[model samples]
Target: MKELQQLLKKFFGYSEFRPLQAEIIQHILQKKDALVLMPTGGGKSICYQLPAIYLPGITLVISPLIALMKDQVEGLIANGIPAASLNSMMSDSEQQQVKQLCIQGKIKLLYISPERVKAEADWFLPRLDISLIAIDEAHCVSHWGHDFRPEYTQLAILKERFSKVPVVALTATADKVTRTDIIEQLRLDNPQVFISSFDRPNLSLTVRRGLNKKEKIKSIVHFIRQHRDQSGIIYCMKRSDTEMLAEELSLFQIKATAYHAGLSPQKREQAQDDFIHDRVDVVCATVAFGMGIDKSNIRWVIHFNMPGSIENYYQEIGRAGRDGAKSDTLLFYSMSDLIVLRQFAEESGQVEINLEKLNRMQRYCETDICRRRILLSYFGEEVEKDCGNCDVCKNPPLRFDGSILVQKALSAVVRTQQQIGIEMLIHILRGAARAELTEKGYHLIKTYGAGRDLSYVEWKEYIYQMIQLGFLEIDYAHANRLKVTPLGTKVLYGKTTAQLTKYMPPEPEKKKTKASTGKKGFKAQPIRPIESESVDEVLWDALKQLRKQLADRESRPAYHIFTDDSLEDMVAQKPITLGDFNQIRGVGQIKLEKYGRVFVSLIRFVLKLPKLEG
Candidate 1:
């Protein structure tokens, strides 16, 4: 334990672990299977990483994303840990070398995709001294999860082959059902489950309903412009929509690129690289764009259209404000979006199950409470205080006692035998309709014009509120026909309280205000150029060339690993010791230990030159 603390301080420089990290680490050290349910940016990696550094044999980390694997491996190496990733990026020869290192116990950790683990053709397992297996994003194995991958089913086999070896499953999002699915599929026997709170206080959440597609696009652009030069993502429902939005953002002088599966592999790689390098400030993409994107400073995430599920919505928005810095999350919803999404669900051919899920999502969109509160509650966490950032908390709309409203609506549905749709029922209440209602002579009913005091829009809003409050529901297979649940029966009998907020549209965008730059007290440092052909410059250039060749061979953009600015900064700083490197910005203690030695060697060679520093 003392040695672990000393190593933690020496490498990562952290004094202690975040909540549950130590417990999870201890569980692994004790050789126990565990499941960790941490929120995004809750230090999920440290739980496995700390254990890997101290344990004998290589810790095999199964991850779904190659980019995430590379970033983490680079981070580990920076911290002076011998970590390597065996992904598609490596050539056959390079892969063989990595496998050899793992077998020889030179590498502390080995990161691979689950698909590679399942592929019997891979010789990674045969050669390595495998200790512990850590599954990052383990929720992908469950069908109930948002991003389910078929290959994850084979991960359970690791338990059989390496029976005594411990397996640790980690994920950022999972509810009760999904958690059960994970335990059942992986056969985790009473694993030590650690679940954390989902609230992210620094993120301000808001939902705006757009009248049409153009207005929706304008709203998204407006939000992005408000937070200019900041990192963000704009999610669209379709690939074509992503392209159109990216083009529009570019025309507005916003730095953005499009990413979707439809794009060529090279283009998608370039787009991700550009975003990570800070060359592009925004990425307009479909749902596939950010599965495991680890760039931490994203300031905002805008959903151009409503998402398919609340779980997906929360996970996507959770990507923002990851740095624990203040950020914004915006969602655009329209009544028509329900129809479009319903049609899409039908086309997927999982008509019964998918439609049921979409119906729940629709009610979530129409809910009038604090949006964040509803979302968190679905994840099995409760927030007693209303979040001040959501639409309901900011400039709250008026709430007429919905008790009477619910009774009337439910009575009308029950009186009419619940056969008609909302349009006919609403028409009966309003006492106004076109020739179709007149032909049915529905106006003769005693409930006719019962709600005539309220306008058509007001009645429609009330029905939506009722649906959200669980008084009414849609029979998905029956052409989405409206029906009252048992809860509706109780509401009609005045057995329940229905408190609903009337939806009020958002105000016009506020005028832009100029922000004051940080020119007070602190002054900007001037850059001094060194003379040409310094020995340090030669080594820096050599490293850059090596990176470029590796990036090219792997079909990845070079700057993803080290930005040009970061490289230049390293050259300028020429840190001679780990301490010196740690003191520099962007040179976190881990990074200094990983790549610092080679750069320090180059600096020492330069300082020995007669024409240079001396």
Candidate 2:
């Protein structure tokens, strides 16, 4: 423990370990396997990094991205630790040098992609001495995980080859099923599992549904404008959308850039570098952007289109408040997005699983309960209190007795013998005289046209809600026929009651009032709130400018020198001397020796500090 603390302070420049970093590191040192389930920005890198410092031969980290490897390797090198990466991005000669370093016991940590590891097995077979194997993004090994990769399934080879070596698998996103799949696929030998809380209180979460593209762009522009000069990312669902939206933001006079896999590696690197250097205020990108970004002051994240799964959504939003600073996230959703995702799922081999996960994502957007609660619940975590920061918590939807509506749908399903799709069910309820219904029924069923008061779209929304609320299940193997669950059976037989959020129409309301489903058509409710607390704007701006100047001089990202959180702490504390500055969170001995005096002077100038402060 003492050696770990001394190493942490000397190399990482931190005084203490986050939640379970120390425990995981010690477990690895004792040669025990561990499976770590932490949230993104939960200091996952340190769990393996600290172990590498103490482990004997070498710690080989299997990362998923070249950019992720480069970012981590550069940070380690900057701290005077011996780290190197072997990827396709490096020249043959460069790769040979790193391999030599590994053999010579000079490289304590090595980063390689799964593909590189697979390709270089011949080279590693004869002579590779590894003390620890860390699988970053271990969730990819599972087909059920949000970002499933077939390449990761091959990672079990490491365990098969080195049966005696202890392994540590880590990921930021995974539910119970995903966790189990990861463990089985990676072939961990009864690894110790560490699951942390999924709650991220620093992020204010909100979702806006049923919006057109115009409204979505308008809302996103407004959100970006609110954060003015801070760095933020706008995630779109496609490369084309990223390019178009980036152009749109540029027309609006916001400094923005587009990032996607379609771009050449050079262009993508430039975009990432510019964003990191604060030359770009907004990055309109696809999933390719945030996975590798280490920037710490991203004040906002906006999903221009809905993500395909809850896991993807959470991981993307997790990128926003990494520094534990106040941040905002807005997700725009519509039924069109759902249709698009369904098409994708239909084409996928795992149609059943993909559709189920997509259903959960849709439920989250349409839910009237607290958004955070639904998100946490998806990860198997329960929250009993309103998070107060999300859209639903601030302006909750009105709940009403939905027994009549539910009973009508269930009766229609029963009359149809429980073997019908949503469209057929809706048609039967609305008394639509289609050829199929007419030929089959002879207009004799008593429950026909019981839902005539509801439109096609309204009935569809209600059926989807009932499915999500656990009253009904879809039999995918049986042509997606509707099947009643125990809850649905009770509700249908009058043994139980149901409550739901009253639907809202698209038309404008005459006045602002809570929506009530009292025999009137539902009207849409608009919700938005100004939730950010006021900070020291003058000091914030001055400190940012100074940091940028220092970054420009050092040719590095501003956050690399001193993060925004650290600068904010400096301003708030008004540190005057070396000792006072040393007490700041991100300040370390190396930074204090190289750049601390300059930052201290800047802080003194900004605060008009006295020669000494008691």
User: Which candidate achieves the best lDDT against the true structure?
Assistant: 2
Tens-digit lDDT track of model 2 for 1-614 = 99888788777777898888888888888888889999987889889988888878888899998888887887787677899999888898998888998988899999999877777766663377888999999999998898888899999888888778889999999989999999999999999999888889899988876566786787777777666666899999889988888889899998999999999989999999889888889999999888777777888899988999999999999988787889999898865677778889989989998899898998888788789999999888997898999878877677788988999898888888887877788898898999998888825688899989998867877887788788888776577789888999999999999987766543332332222111111122211112223234445555666666667777877777777778778768867788888877777667777766766765665555754433
Tens digits of per-residue lDDT for model 1 on 95-194?
9898888778999989999888876334558566778889999889998887788999888888877778888999988878889999889887679899
Q: Which stretches of candidate 2 lie over 4 Å from their true place?
A: 124-128, 399-536, 610-614
Which numbered prediction scores highest in TM-score against the true structure?
A: 2
Clashing pairs in 2: 504-523, 505-522, 505-523
What's the lDDT for all of these models? 0.75, 0.82
Candidate 1 wrongly placed segments (more than 4 Å): 120-123, 343-356, 401-503, 517-614
The TM-score of candidate 1 is 0.74
Model 1 lDDT on a 0 to 1 scale: 0.75
Q: After superposition, how far is residue 577 of candidate 2 from its true place, in Å?
A: 1.4
